[model samples]
Target: MPKRILEMTAIEVARLREDGDHSVGGVSGLYLQIIGASRCWMLRYTHLGKRKRMGLGIYPTISLAVARDSARAAAALVQTGIDPKRAREDEREAARMHDAKQLTFKQAGEAFIKEHEPGWKNLKHIDQWKNTLATYAYPKIGKLLLSQIDQAYVLQVISPIWSTKTETASRMRGRIEQILDWATVHGHRSGVNPARWRGQLEYLLPNPDKVAPIEHHEAVPYEDLPQVYKQLCAIKGQAARALRFVIFTAGRSGEVRGMKWQEVDLFRAVWTIPGERMKSGREHRVVLPPQAVEFLRNQPRRKDREDLVFPSPRGTFLSDSTLSKLMRDHKINGVPHGFRSTFRDWAGETTHHPRDAIELCIAHVIDNKTEAAYRRGDMIKKRVAIMKDWADYATSETTNPA
Candidate 1:
């Protein structure tokens, strides 16, 4: 017969100093195993006539009361004809899977941007996303789980600035909605997008158009163009030349700044801006006047691929503020963009030319589908006369009106 073991007291368990194993025999196969001064609880049980040992936890770290409870639970599993060791392994695997699937809102937004940024045309667009999200969305719920970001939290991000900075806040809402949609598609999250505007946020927030007042850029008067043009011409630099070209062509500042030598056809006196550069995503053909062509020819524009016609001091693309800073330095009371409006006003008030040709010259999107289609021809011959007249009027300071 085997000798019956006595259940050890708390004082006896505390007195244990020697290494090896000590059994407190109220429960079968429960031991306080001490090895080289470290102590822990282990359950030595038999399943299917095979001895199996399972660790409960460390002594003093996991209190003896908790260890006893854990051992009894493992013992109960054995009484139910189940293996507690396999159960514990299954639990650990489940925890690993849960951790692997977790995604924070910042992580998801970054992943979404990385996946889609290659397809975007403007490099500044990525900066826009980073700046807006970092300033607004990331603060409120960036570290929160994707499943945790509900519409209430999204509203918290946009509502404070929605009325004050309506356009920016509106754009932020759209971006957040897009990120959530991407999350859903990739299986990181599941639900109708909380940031969605039409059926959700639109009802909560006031329409941006109704709340925000329209503010147009301050434009130079038509009669003031000669004076502005003279000052721009007198300022000698790439930024000055870029400004003059913008005013002369009525093109966007970005289009003028991003111009490569390859895009200009001086022999034909035409500059073709590719679809990717134009805001309308269509190629724009600008008829260069003799003076305009002459200005460009004097630029030492070598026929080299990717050579910018107007590069910054470092030979990279000029910053957006380059022309504005020139305007400020000369104390010119108008902005670079304001020059486009100056051209538009001049075209409207000073010319007898048809409106369609002028709008097409500035690359404005025509409202009438039929008119827009006819603009495919873009009235090039008529535009040459108009642009020449504009160039002559702009440069002369006192040219007779055509």
Candidate 2:
């Protein structure tokens, strides 16, 4: 007859070993042992003629009933010819692979920049891409795994700003597409880049061009030129003086604001705006009108500064936005830049000057290469006459009858 073995506590099991019961052969059939040191039950079994062991946890953590139940489950797997050890190892490997596949959109974006930033034309181009992505895309999708990204999430990022800030949204979408493309090619993700527009997101979102149509360039009408010019002249401020200088010289805001005392020759009645300052990167000379000359002469001279005629409050070069804001503050609607168009309109309508002379006065490239190559003269005489007329028209009374 087989002898029955009672369940043992951790203390009883330790005492059994201490009593030197070496001939206790029936204990082998008992599948559970209580480790005295840890006060935990362990299950021992044999599968395919090989011995195996599994922990059933501590006394308090795994109750006696639960331990026996768990041991029966492990035994069932053994009887079915499965190795629980190998199954656990496979699960761990799968988890690791899943982690590796998960990468955030921000991570992909940084990788994209690293790969293609070197091919960019210049540092400014690279900075533009980085700034746009950081400002718009990163906040929304930065934490989401690359594979998890979809069109809805991308739309969420862009739609809020799309109508009001079309240009920024357009550039942001392009940057996101570039990053997702990089992720797809590198095997971090698979599928159409969510940022793509052609077939993917085209129907979902409003067309940017339709949603935000371009407003016509703001310019004062040619007929209202004299009255507007008079108003501009009557205004007395640094900004007004700067505007008058820009109109008188027919130069861009940058060129006029960047002017220096050394660039001017008061005796010669000329201001030589350098090639770098000119939009065409070719040096151009302006014959200063008597009003422009007097305006410059009356300006309080700085004792030490070499460059920058229109300095800010700290005496550095004025920001490019300064003039635009000044116009806004004064409620001068139409394009502040439309002043250039106004000048062009006045030149065409009021004078018999050649097209090339007007274009040259505005620093626009004379498109006819043959004429450009052959025409060496600067058309100074005609330009001088044009400048005088502009000054007269800007400062004089309205010619139109009320």
Best by lDDT: 1
Task: Give residue 356's error in model 2 in angstroms.
Answer: 2.3
Q: Could you give candidate 2's per-residue lDDT for residues 292-327 as a string of tens digits?
A: 787787876675565556666677766557777776
lDDT of 1: 0.85
lDDT of 1 by residue, 272-333 (tens): 99998987778999988888887887785544445999887777888878788888888888
Q: Looking at model 2, how many pairs of residues clash?
A: 1
- Residue pairs whose backbone atoms clash in candidate 2: 218-335
Off by over 4 Å in 2: 1-130, 138-161, 171-207, 278-282, 319-322, 325-331, 367-378, 398-402
Give TM-scores for every candidate, taking all chains together and pairing residue i with residue i: 0.67, 0.53
RMSD each, Å: 6.5, 10.7
Kindly report which residue stretches of model 1 are placed more than 4 angstroms away from their true locations once superposed.
1-103, 163-167, 184-192, 207-212, 302-306, 370-376, 398-402
Give the whole-model CA lDDT for all candidates, comma-separated.
Answer: 0.85, 0.72
* Model 1 residue 191 CA deviation in Å: 5.1
